[model samples]
Target: MDWDDLRIFLAVARTESLSGAGRRLAMDASTVGRRIARLEAAVGAALFLKTPQGYALTAEGARLVAPSEAAELAATAASEAVRAEAGITGQLRIGAPDGCANYLLPQVARDLCDAHPGLEVQIVALPRVVNLTRREADMAIAVSPPDTGRLMVQRLVDYQLHLAGHRDYLARHPPLRDLADLKGHRMISYIPDMIFDRELDYLSATGMEVAQISSNSVAVQMQAVRAGAGLGIVHDFAIPFAPGLQRILTDRIALRRSFWLIRHADDRASRRLSLLADALAQGIRAEVLRLEGLLGPCPVRGT
Candidate 1:
């Protein structure tokens, strides 16, 4: 019946662990546990089932999530109404690929924090798609949009990638005048079979040799490229950060892709969520343009 109890319950539900929820709420594990127990007593149903992995939500817990979120939103709205000028406040966890998490999201986070000092942002750098259904993140940035789910998808921005190499490697290797010249040289890329997205499986289609150095992570691939591992397709926004990295065959080979901002459909009515989402989209769009522009005009453009 109490909003505080529902708040704690929701935190535990999302984190799937008392300690994690405690950390987020600035309370200790024992306190979170007691609060959850109290919530269960009030509802007359066990909400979480303990497991080796932590707490797994029971069927009743799954059902409680929606109404609990609705209550949380109402409480937040009431709080915001009293402090209308302070801006939206609360923590938000965003799931994104390492490429964006490491390079792009930081910029967005910085801007958002500067604008709204009370806001907190958590970046969950996951190699796989973030599951909104399980509440893996409050929101996610995905390379592809999902057709099935109770979700709201927004096209955040379009970005480009190109085969690139470190200046040191370029100096030692034979000149890369065209795609044909890429055949004999080594490459740094994702493991072909481990490629999670069809969009990421294009290294083979480039007529280049198989990857000599591989990782599932874009951040790792970027590091390998900078360490002179081999040629890798890298985000344009990321290229400027790697001091010696330069696009290879930019005119002949460029991959254009889009980033989508995804949210649970149930959050569609939350004004606080909308505010945060708008800031995220705008910040990402601006930062991508700024970073990519550091290299001057590219032969390709975003769709």
Candidate 2:
């Protein structure tokens, strides 16, 4: 029943590893283990089952998750209420796609930091989905909205992707007049097997079987195309920044993808989250407008 113990338990449950929880909490692994033991003893139940993979929650621990989350929310709300009087101060972690994280989020982070000098922001730019339930990130910019989870999901913006190639590469290769011409050109894209999200399967929409040059990172893929490696699907927002890149088949080949902003349902009540979400949405909207100006509005397609 101690709030501190419940906090420790929640961290361990979310991470499923003592060392992970310890690192997040700034405590050593032994200290985190002892805290978990104390929490289990106080509750008079074995909260976790230790396994080679990590800790698996016991039935009792699973049952406690909801209430623990509620407690955490209430505590956060209380803390935020007090902090509001003095101005917001806390860390906000965002999980974003590589393109957005590298090209977009930095400006957003700067604006957020300038507005609230005490706030800290971290952006994790990875291709994989971030598990909000595990607190991998406070919020995330994802390609698709999650179908199941206690999450607050919203469609942030729709952006375009186009088949792009460097000027030198296009001049060296045969003209790409139609879809069939794609067969003759080298392609750069995400590795088919390494694509973590189905939304990232860009080449498939082009009727291409595979890419000759592949990478898991969109940034890398873009670089490959920029270096005249081959034609690759690049975000419209990113194209303006890369010199000598041209959108190929502008009218024939364009893919529209959406960015969804997601956050843990429990965190919705926190003022910091509310403010951060608003800032993220605004930044994305501005970027989308810029992208639209560069590439024209995304053509509506049937679902």
Candidate 3:
């Protein structure tokens, strides 16, 4: 019945682990457990079913989801109203692909937090789709917009990817005169089956069938290329950081892809969410411009 108890329940349901929920709430695991027990007693019904995998919401808990979310939104609105008279203070979670999350989000997060001292930001670097409907994240950068969700989607920015290799690897191997020559090279790429998003299937466009070396992480793939393993597709924004890596066939081959910013429709009017979204979009646009300066103009129009 207490709003604080409902907040704990929401966190536990979203994270599905006592420790994870506790970390979000800044409480210890035992305390989170005790609170859940107290909440169940108040409701006079079991809320979560414990399983080896994690806590699963019971029927009673599932029924509480909508009301809990409504309460959360109302609390957010109230907080935002007060923030106008004071300053912004709340948590904002963003979900993004590992590549972007690892390379880009940290600096942006720091800047946002610095500007708003009381604000907290968490970045979920996940390869799978982040369910905005389930409150997995307040906002997400996705390859494609959802078709069925009640969401507000906007094109964030377009970035370029190109085939690249380490300077040492290029010197040791035959020169890549054309696309066909790539067939003989030990290409590095994502594990095909592990590519969660269709937009990540860069190899298919290259007409390359084999990946002699592969990894699920872009950071690993970049490391593989840096170690002289082989040529691989890499983001232009990432290339500037890896001094030894050089773009191959810059004019002949360029891939353009875009990231879409998505959030729940209900959160559209939230001042904090709107401000954060604008800041995110600006940061991404600035990065894209920097990448284009280094990689030459993007080959495709309106990516």
Clashing pairs counted in every model = 0, 0, 0
Model 3 accuracy (lDDT, Cα): 0.85
lDDT of 1 by residue, 31-96 (tens): 999999999999999999999999999999999988998997788668767876767777889999
Extract clashing residue pairs from model 2: none
- Candidate 1, residue 148: the lDDT equals 94
- Candidate 3 lDDT by residue in tens digits, 89-169: 778899998778876778778878888888889999886878887678999998777788899999988888888899998
Candidate 2: C-alpha RMSD after superposition = 3.3
Candidate 2 or 3, higher TM-score? 2
TM-score of each: 0.88, 0.93, 0.90
Question: Comparing 2 and 3 by lDDT, which wins?
Answer: 2
Q: Which tens-of-lDDT digit does each residue in 64-167 have in candidate 2? A: 98899899999998898888787768888999989889877887788888988998899999879999989989999999999999999999988888888999
Superposed Cα deviation of residue 98, candidate 1 (Å): 1.6
**Which candidate number has the best TM-score?**
2
